[model samples]
Target: MRTQIHSHLQDNQCLELFILEGDASRIRELSHLLNRNIKTVYSKLVSLPHE
Candidate 1:
């Protein structure tokens, strides 16, 4: 897994990145919980095609 954070020009805001791997079900669950937060400005979930 990888994570990154950067300061936003507005100063009051910032950007965050989280790369998660493992069971798809757990990932989706975690992503859902994160998106439910009122502080999350934007969120997206992307998965690679199954091999």
Candidate 2:
């Protein structure tokens, strides 16, 4: 997951770009990227778009 997130971040670089790409459910992608469960990631996210 960390590998995937790093790859994605390296490609996106900007949070807005990452969000616009629609690859995630907001910054929870960070948690998701870290191999976190979807529910936990969602719970940690406040529905705000982030990098």
- Candidate 1 Cα misplacement greater than 4 A, ranges: 3-9
Q: Say which candidate scores most in TM-score.
A: 1
Evaluated against the true structure, the overall lDDT of model 2 is 0.38
Assess candidate 2 and give its TM-score to the true structure.
0.19
State each model's CA lDDT, in order.
0.81, 0.38
Q: Per-residue CA lDDT of candidate 2, range 1-51, in tens?
A: 222222333443422212223445554556466446442222233344456
Which prediction has the highest lDDT against the true structure? 1
**Worst 10-residue stretch by lDDT in candidate 1?**
2-11
Report how far off residue 21 is in candidate 1 (Å).
1.1
Clashing pairs in 2: none
Cα error, residue 50 of model 2, in Å, equals 14
lDDT of 1 by residue, 2-27 (tens): 56566675858777777766789998
